[model samples]
Target: MKAGGGDGGSSVSDEEWERFLRASLEGVPDAPEEPSARDRAAAARRPPERAADTAWRAYTPPRRRSRKGWYVAGFVASVALLAVAFAPGGVTGLFGDDARGADAAPLAPESVAPTAPPDAGPEAVRPTLAEPFKGSPAARWADGPAGITVPEARATGWMDRAEVARALRLSRDFLVASNLEPGVLRGERPAGAIALINPRQRDVQDYLAAAFRSPGEANDPVLLFSRFDPAQARLVGDVVKTRGRLTYAEGEKGAVRVTADVTFVYPIAPAGGGDAVVRTIVRREVVMSWDDPAKVITEPGTFSLVSYRADMTNAGCGPATGRLIPSFGGGGGGTASGPAVDPYDRSTSMDERMGAAGDEECGTATRS
Candidate 1:
């Protein structure tokens, strides 16, 4: 091959690069000083450099280098093409493939949003609001009616006409049971039963009869018995003053199924007559059940017994009449009920609260 020959990265000239390569390798072999002459002389040099150099210059280098550059460029172009073709959808999604699309496509517009909780607001999700009870197992309580092991759930006490008669059999009986003296009862008594004051008292009896319909108005004033007779419970008094009505609220509180606070009044009747003579004061409450029975105590604050009840309530219900009463009880506040007198104002005697019956109230009216 001649001097000035081609190499892979360079084009071939009149003289192959072989001569130049040989000259270069042979320690800068001189060519003629004159341009043209020098070129010719350089071309006259012996065989081109090493065989490796000759072959490299003759064919391999130029093509190989150009192709390598082009291969790199092609690869870059392929990437760019991919980006351009799929980029409109989104850069991150340039691959144009979606694994979750099938499941997503069929849902309605509203369904796109996640499920919401009943209590949770739109701003955030709520796992649950019913947090479990904390503290010792003995102290914790639930949110509904507790266990039911007794029939006290039914009512207070039930009595026959005889029991009602005992409530007010004789004037002296009324005095003894009610802690009143003959002087106090027989007009000779200021604090005696009204029966002593009104015997055929039409207005008194009529008015007292009207009150029997709304027992709630009495609010467990008091119930004191005179003596048993085969007749209805006598009116030791009539409801006159009531309080705590505004506190008549009902709802499940903690363990209690139902709780309510109500106040009422009852008027005392003359010991001899069947008419109301004085008014009494009373405060009471109603409780249905508890959340934790184990922790339950038959105390005034823990639960309630249906010791006494009323005929009407502001809740728009007719007078509640039923055969129910408490079994065991003596005295209590806020929820107290029995045939006893109020230690406070003494306006309402114990007989009124207990649904006391007597001979005075007997023939006056029959049991409804």
Candidate 2:
């Protein structure tokens, strides 16, 4: 064939063909073979692209979670925990006595039922008498109608012997000072004697006031200074001397009983005519109810003369005469005459003087 053949002739130059073949084989390597079906399936399952995406995601920072959502979840968990802890039988059941540790002490049975103190017995409730009256001389006088009750014995102790003696002396001195002293009876009241009389006993006051009246009207035998008019009489001699012996006893209704034998002299000048000095002896027994000691100390006259009796004798005047001034009855009144006597005579007793003075002058004798 011609290299330049016309129409359908082949025109490949040898140099061009060789050059093309050399260029094709110059740097080309062989193609890899196709994978098997099993390998393709495993490759599809493994997804190389997914593994590459995971690796890329790991390198990137994760998205920030919402703080409010986390806070709400934590709060709900805390509230549920608190509810379990505070439920009635929840926490206590977990840590109660049965659940206590081995080192804890067991409770004792005696702790639940404690022992009581011993009883004081019957003697503690029994009543007792005061110390002074327990074994006193006054105990012998316990059998009278006005005998002291158990309650009375427990109320106050008997007056001390020295105190009783002093009171008796002071009473005797008061009588003499009030009656024998000049100008003492001039007033409507015998101030000195009235001051001593218990104010609660108005009858005693009235009886004392009547002593200043004429002889028959005066029922109180304790008044020895005047038998003639007390308003007109004057004291003629020295202050009268008085001596007394006293005994203390118990009386009903918490009273103190005093018995005294008193001796005194009374000297006076009669309003009508003469001057006379009388020596008088009297036995007086009286029941006195004292006020509370705290009150009596401040107000000396807080004692009441609940009952009294005077048995009087004047050797120069007459025989022994008696007047009982009981608290229950009213005081004595004027009495009728029985004899003629000198009103100022030291030998004349108050009863004799009053009997001679006339009923209008002296009060009637209430005592039998």
Candidate 3:
């Protein structure tokens, strides 16, 4: 009982209890003061070094994507740019200071039109065949003939005197080579005659063909001259001679008109008679048109005979002479005058004296 009462009495008072709680609080020291909401907001507002570092890291540029691929792409772009810059019209815009820009107005058509080139002048006059053949033996022979007289060749405008003379010479050569040449009597065709006349001239070709047909029963002049039928009539001697003189005048449209007086002398024998010498005189007129120099369709120095005439005479070949007689009558010979009448002036008369003489020598048909 005494122990129980003493234990009860030992219980602490309220003040003592209060002092104990205060002492415990003081001894523990107040828990550190918690930051207020305002303090926390201020702290957050301050820019911290760590926060700056974090921002810098976040904002840092990403490493360039595959520098190798970028370099390749850049190189490809540069090549393409160079190709475009160096093209024809492209170079003008890129390097020319005066070149118009893309936004500039286009040039007028008149300003950009191309200019024409200057024309070349006319061609020079060329030399003719006579220049090279002057003073030749053929010329001397040509002058030696003693039949009808021919007018001298005359050049006018672009006409060449030499060419006229050459044409005459060629005509003479064709006749002589075709009829008088020794081998031609054996049915040989005359290549020279064929070459002289233009085949395109139908009339002239036909005339020449008829004249040069093969020797037959017909008494054609060509056959008579060739003496192809020796049994009936033949040239007696091997000696056959020819001589001629010529005159040339200009004709309409730049054509050349030629007149030739020629003589052929030979000996002949009839079928039942003795040999006798024969002299034949002839006059020929021909018109020659020029050959195109730039073309080979016709031969150079060859001509087309637009007009032609022939007059003939023979001696020692008449009925009384007992020789092969030519049917054509012999006429008086003509005299030659120097130059040609002016072809440009149609009103100008031809030399009446010479023309009259030609008429007497040949006939009205031989008049030019």
Per-model RMSD to reference: 56.4, 65.8, 61.2
Model 3 misplaced stretches (Cα beyond 4 Å): 1-157, 161-165, 185-187, 210-228, 241-243, 271-298, 312-368
Worst lDDT run of 10 residues, candidate 1, spans 64-73
lDDT (tens digit, per residue) of candidate 1 on 1-368: 11211121213331342233223222112321211111100112111112221211221110000000000000000000001011111112211222111111121111111232111112211111111111111012111111000111221123233432222122222222122221211111122232321122222223223222222322111221111111222123111122221111122222323322233322222233332222222233232232222232221112222122222111111121110111111111122111112112112312232232311110100000
Alpha-carbon shift of residue 364 in model 3 (angstroms) = 18
All models: lDDT?
0.19, 0.26, 0.30
Query: How would the candidate models be sorted by TM-score, starting from the highest?
Result: 3, 2, 1
- Give the TM-score (vs. native) of candidate 2: 0.32
Judging by lDDT against the true structure, name the best candidate: 3
Question: In model 1, where do residues sit more than 4 Å from their true spots?
Answer: 1-241, 245-254, 274-276, 285-368
> What does candidate 1 score in Cα RMSD to the true structure?
56.4
